[model samples]
Target chain A: MTQATRVHVAVPNAPYDVHVGEGVLQGIAAATAGADRVAVVSDREVCALHGDLRRHGVDAPMLEFDGGESIKTLGVLEEVLDFCAASSLSRSSILVAYGGGTVGDLTGMAASLFKRGLRVIQVPTTLLAQVDASVGGKTAINLAAGKNLAGTFHQPHAVFCDTGLLGTLSEAEYQSGLGEVIKTALIEGEPALAQLESISRDLGARAVTALSDTVARCVTTKARVVVSDPEERGARRSLNLGHTFAHAIEHAAGYGRVPHGIAVAVGLQLAASASERVYASSTDLGERIGRLLSAFGLPADLEELRSRYSLGAALTANALIEGLGHDKKGRVGAPEFVLMRGPGDIELGVMIAEEELRDLLA
Target chain B: MTQATRVHVAVPNAPYDVHVGEGVLQGIAAATAGADRVAVVSDREVCALHGDLRRHGVDAPMLEFDGGESIKTLGVLEEVLDFCAASSLSRSSILVAYGGGTVGDLTGMAASLFKRGLRVIQVPTTLLAQVDASVGGKTAINLAAGKNLAGTFHQPHAVFCDTGLLGTLSEAEYQSGLGEVIKTALIEGEPALAQLESISRDLGARAVTALSDTVARCVTTKARVVVSDPEERGARRSLNLGHTFAHAIEHAAGYGRVPHGIAVAVGLQLAASASERVYASSTDLGERIGRLLSAFGLPADLEELRSRYSLGAALTANALIEGLGHDKKGRVGAPEFVLMRGPGDIELGVMIAEEELRDLLA
Candidate 1:
């Protein structure tokens, strides 16, 4: 068992720890030590691949369902909450979310609303979830109007990111997580970005040690930002370095067509390009990030993204810009864009003129 | 225009003032001063009677729906959220919940969930709402399973309790509000209780000054308790004095049939009786409370409640106890009961044996 690296998220009122390593799944026992009742909600595929709670000697009820972006809806969220109610889970109970981002999102939401709120432990199974989704306290469900249009800031009791679980991810899915890793590394600046650039090949090969270190770094950066701005009121918005464009791209290409992390990869490049134009900075930030993303065999440009996903006319610049109007983070026409001056020098709530945005998209 | 009394609810992270007076509705403008957009969700009846946002010189879009316990469902809550989204309410915007408890519950729940939470200014139009629901940060929407089964602790930006609005309440509705008033007074003890007893005649006659003072007193008690324990983990349970039994009674008697406050009046009597038996105290506390409730024309006993609501065998002790199993505050078998040793001395999480509870109900 590889030694797990722990990152403490100091969110006010509900501070918790994140464990990242090869066999860190074993940490679940300690995380839920004194919980009167523990309910594990997992993706059926993940459960099939890596046994259920009993594998860790936990005698608790488990709910396994098909997990994906599609399941992040109010209906599915209600189903999860119903399962919680049926399991007779109480306030003192702990709910373990065992899956990718979708399962964690649904379970976190259910935990927040069930009897006004309950403790939740996240066991993220995917790379994207481990590096980003699992660390943030933002839990959401997509509405017909937009993705993650409705959500709550319900922090987890703990997060366990087992690098060993990444072995089962498909190559494309693995690359999807690398998208968020690059985004996090960019936002983190310094050694994190340098480290990611150096270990790009090892990460692509699914090296457990590399993955664990990267996850720990990402979580540490996220935790610091979250502690400073738990509600995303100020400094936390910087974490959305590439999310504004990524969400728009995903919406234009139709959700689930372009994996979120992949879209984020393209978004990171877009942000870098916009930064160069907006700030006129004499930095090769865009080219450097592009090279790093390309090294991991991910799309780093809009043209590449469109070709890779077979997203032809659907992902047009206008459609992507139109989709921005629905971003949960922004108001109607003047959507807040997170622009980059360089690594660690990210600007939040930057309002680019419509024509400037249009020119960049074109 | 009576002088408005401000009760500051010092909940952590988001503290707000509750303004109680005859024309306090006019305070809406200042409560939502810097909000870029203000969306008013009101009861249609209340809107027709008291006029809409225009009356307060606020130019905001309004969604007026029929407000009742039945409308406190996820569907209505969703409509309210959709309305918010349609109104383009951003994080900086304010949502004014203008109605009774149902409207407040639904609107507050929506405000907490939309865009991960927005500012909400509660303009409670009912005495029950003014005294209890509006002051507390408990936002909820009922599920098919139970009342307030899904909720969040999203404190309002401010609360406007216009005593003038209570003039429109029916005799039964006014008495229902008095039930909560009596419960609040008992929990508060001393001057609050004494003041209520003294002003009983004036309050019953809808005297504005009396109503304002009572509302302010109740809010003060609630505010103090909420400030000490915002999340209902410890001392906050004391506020749930009659709620455990009250919820069970409502469940067995069927919701909407017995107004919440009336059910609470009966529940208070049951609690007082149970306290006597459990603590073996010889205080005529139950009788005194019974007399006070009787003076307000609220049912003080199960027989009177049965006669008042024409509720037959549906309110059996066994059924009510069964309902207790589903109390959100307790475990399945042993529901937490708040028993009182005296007016000020309230005990929380008291576990009464099933037989003892049955005997008390009998």
Candidate 2:
């Protein structure tokens, strides 16, 4: 992809570009001209897919780890540290995360820690990562306690979102990305929702041209919000409109069993329903959300997920509610929920009381 | 002790106050007025010395971990993450790192990771931490590969350097701080060296009032350097002048065999000697440096360290040379060394040859 189809991710002092296109990875070497050494941290599969990244002005040894949610941990992070120190990766060196969000999160953290924040470039391969994880400075590794329990806000020096990688993704993974794209569309207000509506079928059909435009739109929306509130004080929390419930669903259903984007789709439906019921929000966004989910070929019906995960069961409900309280964006006791008001508006930091939350599933 | 001694550390985006006084820790509650909750991470020793920080506006639970340089590891950092999660520490929550440099490093890292950075306040108890680690936003945890191999730069919301804490230190522990004090004095140039000369007798005798002014001057000097180059691009690397040889000496002597300050005292002596040799422009700053070390009650003789650590041996020389290459501020081949030009001036980033380093002890 060309730099022309790029969005400037304004992270205040550390602004960077998120380039979306085909053959974009080739530009990484030029982008990291000042880096004395470039170290690529990717998974074995991705490394196989995109041959040795050492040719890209990288003298240091590459660190390839096992992929998936299970691999994101402090143990793996330690291994990353050992590789860096052994390779003698200095502050002048740059770490290029050449995989999906899981690899990006792990590598980003290693860069931040190794010699107190080295320059990092996010080369997101998965659709879920390219649109969502690329722009935001959120880098994390899951702990036994919870997902994203150990992480920091380390913005990448630049992000290379090459849509060419989508050609190799499985149908399930591709659909997973559509879930987040739908979520982003809802957050972007009416026009984005309309654009998403027009492109959903093309996206479902895997049209290459449609993929590029969709990725750019989602990235632009995310960049605008993150720039306005990088630290998630108020406005940025709106981006987590469905994430409060999504995290709980992921935890209960078990991570990776159901992809994060799919869970976010379900959570957005939950948010629309809750917003309509609790606030009597003038617009009935739930119907529109359901249609969007269907159009994107996602699991629009909660009945299937509820039955599968047993949402009515005490254990599952408790896990969901407990997860909400531990949601990093919300306060400890008073958990914040983002409720929709149709189109471009969503009320962030709306605290849902225990009773309302208890009956949320019902 | 009063607010007059406070130094404002201008760290670009994250400016903070370093309050130094007798009972300054008492004002912490007022300082963190906007904090919804304050959770302290300190060892039993600091807790006993400072008492429960809850009295200082920390209503949240305290996370007390094992103390020492050994405690600076990812495993302990994970435990810290658990504590923050269990405590349900939101983005709004404040983390008070109470103790020495080790505690500050670990806690500061945890603060940066937990919810992508909480408002961290550095309450450094040791003299070394107060004068040095307090200003720079350098937070780290050690890995098996090396010391400070894993870390990130997370600036504290504020730093409370209460000289009152220095009163509780053991003779060795108190003297450990003097190493950094002397190093700072040298970095500050002739005026600070003169100040150290003036106060050395009172400080050597363990007079408390003299400790306050010395700590303030060192903090101010560090603040000026860190504010200009927080990431150690150029002038900031000068801070590691003595540290390069100091690391080698420490590794050769074995950690804790020669305390950090003692090694620094020796390292400063080495820098002065090396500068005199290589530069040849004429200045016996080494003699003045030796006297300054004696006045500060630090080990002035490299011969003592060399004899004790068996420096003439291949193992020690190799370790010292190996350690110099790994110096954080310098590249692999071109290791940076800070050398003295005159009283208030110093030449930084001087590359010493291998043969010179090999025969350094001889």
RMSD per model, one decimal:
1.4, 2.6
Top candidate when judged by lDDT against the true structure: 1
Candidate 2, pairs of clashing residues: A1-A22, A113-B151, B179-B261
Interface RMSD of each: 1.5, 1.4
Model 1 lDDT on a 0 to 1 scale: 0.87
Candidate 1 scores a chain A TM-score of: 0.98
Query: Candidate 1 residues A128-221, lDDT tens each?
Result: 9999999878999877777887889999999999998999998888899999999898888867788888898888888877888888888899
- Local distance difference test, each candidate: 0.87, 0.79
Q: For model 2, what is the alpha-carbon lDDT of residue A109? A: 86
- Which 10-residue window of candidate 2 chain B scores lowest in summed lDDT? B306-315
* Poorly placed runs, candidate 1 (over 4 Å): none
| Per-residue lDDT of candidate 1, residues B256-291 (tens digit) | 888998888888999999999899878978888888
Clashing residue pairs for model 1: none
Model 1, residue A40: displacement in angstroms? 1.6
